[model samples]
Target chain A: MVNILANPARFLRLAGAVLPWCWAAAAVTGGVGLWLAVFVSPADYQQGDSVRIMYIHVPAAWMALAAYTLVAVFSAVALVWKHPLAHIVAGAAVPLGAGFTAICLVTGMLWGKTSWGTWWVWDARLTSVLVLFFLYLGLIALRGAFDDAERGNRAAALLALVGFVNIPIIKFSVDWWATLHQPASVLRIGGPAIHPSMLWPLLTMAVAFMAYFAALLILSVRAEIAGRKLQALLVAAGRNEPAADGLQGEAR
Target chain B: MTAAVTEFFRMGGYGAYVWPAFAFAALVLGGMAWRVLARLRASEGALDRMRDRAEGGRP
Candidate 1:
């Protein structure tokens, strides 16, 4: 199934058909999620209205990890199977992942300030997430560092695969070390510990964020493919020559 | 609605932190979407320019 969907043209057609639905779903889910999170969900007994941030923070954090996993998986497929579309999909995911990671960091800090009386802490979970953010930056930077597009893709793919080691570290940081960050509530061996009222909106927002990521990622990949086509057109027109055959050319 | 709005903005006395967090998230998301659309438009413009050039050269 993955191999069959590797064709760029086929993927593009499928994405076009699905993109509208993804966007609509994201919008609908986000609207409902926000409503439920803000109005319907009961305030935390301890945190009060500030608990609302969880509606955004938790989903962003989830997507941060999810997006990185996607990048690593796509990278692996692109390398092992030599799927061209995989590279584009992985490359398109970097900015979105970085954005999600940033959201997690910023929101975590904000929540921390209220809960822990500090805006920042070097706790195990926080530190590992910070490392994950840097790994994303490194991948983004390495993608453009080579002179050959293929070389850049390969190098970025390798970095993504290597950097995946941090994902597990981020996931288990709270368990591995006593930290201010809470242990898993929604995902656990015994099942979610969160109350149903909070759990529903959280899950809804998570779905909304995932759909939003899908929509944005498809748009980014389409833009990238279009940009590449434009470059080819320019080359054919003799209006411009291909840039230096380095990794940097492929980075964008 | 007014009471809810007031309460939300109050953020139970943590308004400073809460509102800014929400605003920042919105800004980042909005900025990303805008940037992507802008790049798409720029690429489309370049394609148009190339097509125009090709047509003029042909005539």
Candidate 2:
């Protein structure tokens, strides 16, 4: 499994076969999930219609943390095993992770404004997620900072591993502190605290988001692989003909 | 029919907050999808062109 995953050509072929199914799953599940959320689910007794926001908010928040953990794990593998594809996967994940984090934060704010009567807060859960957003930004900037691509990948990998401490902080912050954000309702030590009517839709949406993430992650990794191949080809061409060697070296 | 549609959109008086939240999530996710597709297309195109160049510009 590791060998197949580590081989880019094989990985690409596997991804090609799986991509269509992923897109189909995402579309089907997302449509059903939306229907359930918008039309089928009952309004919360306390939060009322604003509770509808939970469908989007909870899934986005879950994806945000999940994506970052993926990055950190891939980054670790890339550093320890020096697998180039692992770095590519990690790099592909950063933007999507950041996107999810942004969605979570913004939707949280909107939900908060309705329920909490405030747009901003300095609570630990909120603050930690904000830090997570910046960590993603820092990794992106670091990845592109160095002219040497390998150096940049290594630097970004290091940053990803170092910043992983915040993951637990974000997960536990609600329980650890008194925050406006609710505690983990679906994924907790005890069974999900949520009602079944709402739970099914939320779970479906989570599946849809994950499928979407997988499809996009595959696409981004393929693009990064192609980009790397193009660079390698340019370098090889320069090597065959010594006349343009200086120019190619300078170009790089 | 129209009343039901309006009520759905209104989201029972929290429409302002609810709609924007969902809309922003759509925008971000949709934008990422667009960008990822563009990147894949551009990179594959470049690779094809480079391969053609290696083959002495032969199609």
Top-scoring candidate (TM-score): 2
Tens-digit lDDT track for model 2 on A16-54? Answer: 999999999999999999999989999998999999999
Full-model lDDT for every candidate:
0.85, 0.91
DockQ score for model 2: 0.64
lDDT of 1 by residue, B1-59 (tens): 99988876787887887777778778777876887788778887776775565556653
lDDT of 1: 0.85
Candidate 1 total steric clashes: 7
Q: Please, what is the TM-score per model?
A: 0.91, 0.93
Which 10 consecutive positions of candidate 1 chain B have the poorest summed lDDT? B50-59
RMSD of each: 4.9, 3.9
Model 1 RMSD to the real structure? 4.9
Pairs clashing within candidate 1: A144-A247, A144-A248, A146-A246, A146-A247, A147-A245, A147-A246, A147-A247
